[model samples]
Target: MPSETARELRRRLHQQQLISAFGREALRGAGLDGLLQDAARAASEGLDTDLAKVLQHLPGEQCLLIVAGVGWGPDVIGVVRFGTDLASPAGFALRTGAPVISNHLGGEGRFRTPQLMVEHGVRRAVNVLIRGEAGAPPFGVLEVDSRDAQEEFSESDVAFLQSLANVVGLAIDRDRDRRDRDLLTREAHHRVKNSLQIAQTLLRLQLREVEDPEAKRQLEQAARRIMTIGAVHERLFSGPAIGLVVVATYLRGLVEDLRASLGVGDGGRPLALEVTPASEEAVWDGDRVTTLGLVATELVTNAFKYGRGTVTLRFEIAALTGGGTLVVADEGDGPPPGFDQAKGGLGMRILTTLLRGGGLAAERPPEGGFRFVATLAPPPAGNGG
Candidate 1:
């Protein structure tokens, strides 16, 4: 048999191990309910007890609600309530901000054993207050229980429970902070999107009042660029993936919008736009999406103005390197004689600027059509990986 001193050391070591594990989960940002449930279980296991619970104080109702627990009936957890007065052991710890050790609840005079505990044949229990950050209201109480009549709740057990309670408080606080930051980021995106939309609307009004073909074309191009940015922001705030734009969804939407704005070809027939289906769960950062959007708009616009027949836009993922390729082609006799990418018009200048280091491939496909291929580097690590 282990000596009394060695046995005490073993219990302390076990308690420290439980505390360390609970602290890690809390730091990992587990949700509030999950943290509370795990805290209850940890408290019970730390003390080798039969049951444990975490009660959230509802000041409005003047009662402690059993929000999480271990070894309790489904009806008891989330359904049981205890008064806040000092007569109750858990209440005394919560109301007075002190730990309570009730080892002789059956004959105790200091506090009453809750009826729910009595029904379960509980003979001893310990309670500790779960406090919030400084200046914040107290969260509630954490309690562990034992059913063995010979079981004793010691001061060491109270210390372990308090340590677990502190970790729970910090986790809840950090979770709230993270939620607040996320909300603020979403709000900022929404505001920027609305502002861009307003700018696009103003540009469209200016385009309507002008009659010079040159000026009208410039304004129209500017409006389209603004629209692309606005659309990207809309997707960022509207979707579940944070700071990411789905490659397929974004390109498809952009092609449809451009088709609506640019209208039909010289043959009085609707312009044909073919978008290849997305093959992977690939995503890109906002800046990359914006650059790609602008490049696509320029190439597609040029195809409609100079080329003829169906315009096809294809996206391919490099399987080994995780990079991407954008292929924009049109069924035409290709660019007129002597067309150079680095020495062309405004559209060509924009394309060259955007694809400077990214590598651009322009050729007349074997079938006698113009094709512009842009290579996109993979997104940074931790984004859509």
Candidate 2:
């Protein structure tokens, strides 16, 4: 037989494995319900207990809700709730960031349902508070019960269970963070899309008043640019990731819209816009998309007006000698030599302002086609595509 120390080490290793698995499973779970279920199961296995119950602190209700329970009857777990104002041991433990250990539940002064505890044969119990991080409120509580009244919990047992509670707290915080981020992202996208739609409507109405064909054409081009911005926002609202719009997908949709808007039917051979990323995917923030959309509008609009052959738009992140460069290229005749940035009128001025606002430098490609290159900073970490 193995020595006591060897058996203890083996048990701790098993517990560590359980904690790691629990953390992963908890994160993958859909919502708070899934998290509660995972926590209960993990707690039971990690603490070697027959019964485990998870109680989330619902401050609005002024009570601890029994979210999940394992190895317990409906009478014992279902009807048990601790009020915030009540002086129960469990509540006290949670409020004070301490642990409550009762070898005999019937004799415990703070248990509200001593007779129920006796009826259910819950002889001993322990409740630990799952406190949140520094400066945050408590997340919840973990309650473990055993039928054996004589079984006394060791200090090591308490420490191990406390570690499990810490993991639970971390999981809860992460889920909350993810939810808040998603909400903010959705709101931002919704507002931007609404604003762009309004701008498109205004531009379309203004186009009707302009008698000059050239002026009407310019107005229409500006409207199309606004529509492209709206398209980016639409993708952001529909996609799963917050604050991230896929460059290739956004470009493809924009090109298709441009083809339809320009009245290039199936037989007419629509302008082809293709984006090949340097990486598998390129994710841009709202500000970046706004700047890039304007640049794309200028290039694609010029292509439609002047280019004879097919028009293709490609985007790639390049490793510049100094830093990274975002290149937007199209298969069209290059801009006129010495193209005046300031004298090219409102469109060029808007493009210049947007690029400068995003802390980027834009220039045309040296080869035959029109290409706009902008140097951009890396996006924030964890803003996944």
Best by lDDT: 1
Worst 10 residues of 2 by lDDT: 317-326
Question: Which lDDT tens digits does candidate 1 get at residues 1-385?
Answer: 6698898899999999999999999888777999899999999888897699999999999999999999998998899999999999988998899999988898999988889999988998899999979988888999998998776778888888999999988887887677888899889988999899999999999988999999999999888888888878877744445668876778878877887778653554344444444544566767777888888888878777788777887777666666677788888777767878778888888888877557788788676878888887665666553
Candidate 2 achieves a global lDDT of 0.69
170-200 per-residue lDDT for model 2 (tens digits): 8778888888888887887799889999999
Model 2, C-alpha of 230: deviation from truth (Å): 2.5
Clashes of each: 0, 0
- The prediction achieving the highest TM-score against the true structure is 1
RMSD of each: 3.0, 6.8
Query: How well does each candidate superpose onto the true structure, as a TM-score?
Result: 0.87, 0.63
